[model samples]
Target: MPSANQAQAKVQKLRDQMAQMQASTVEQIAQLKAEAQRKYEELQLQFKTEVAAREVEVTRKYDELQLQLQNIMKMFQQSQNRSS
Candidate 1:
């Protein structure tokens, strides 16, 4: 049978191991949170960049369509003047 001192020593060792495991778990959680935040910011920036690019493209298309419409109106007016 183990003596009281031996039992106490075993208990202390177990306690130390448990404490180390807890500390390691806490550190890992902190690291994961930091990584998640970095990824979120990266994705947000990418989304904003894509949105800005699309806005510019849409504006360019709108301008092109407006110019085409104006050209058609001018051609129709010219035809009417020739008829008159």
Candidate 2:
């Protein structure tokens, strides 16, 4: 039969092992959460940057169309003056 002191020592060792494993698991969970948050923030920034770039592109296209219309109007006015 195992001695009382030896059995008590074995139980204590098992308890220490369990505590260490729990601490390690908790730390890993915290690290994973932090990583996920960082990725989310980076994606948000990228989305905002893309949206800003698209707004600039649209504005430029609209300006080009406005200039084209102005040129067409001036050409018609000159033609009318020559006919007078």
Candidate 3:
């Protein structure tokens, strides 16, 4: 059987190990949260950039379609004038 002093020392050692593990877990959690935040911000920026690029492209395409329609109308007017 172990002596009382030896039992007490063993108990103290176990307590110290538990405390160290708890501290390490807390630190790991903090690091993971920071990394997650950084990734979220980066993705948000990329999404905004893509949205802006798409908006510009859509606007350009709309303008081109409008111009083509106008040209067709003018051609129709010219043909009518020739017929008259």
Best by TM-score: 1
Sorted by TM-score, highest first, which candidate order results?
1, 3, 2
> Mind giving the per-residue lDDT tens digits that candidate 3 earns over 1-84?
999999999999999999999999999999999999999999999999999999999999999999999999999999999999
TM per model? Answer: 0.92, 0.78, 0.87
Candidate 1 regions exceeding 4 Å error are none
Give lDDT per model, in order: 1.00, 0.99, 1.00
| lDDT for model 3 | 1.00
lDDT of 1: 1.00
Candidate 2 wrongly placed segments (more than 4 Å): 76-84
Model 1 pairs whose backbones collide: none
lDDT of 2: 0.99
Looking at candidate 2, the ten consecutive residues that score lowest on lDDT are: 1-10
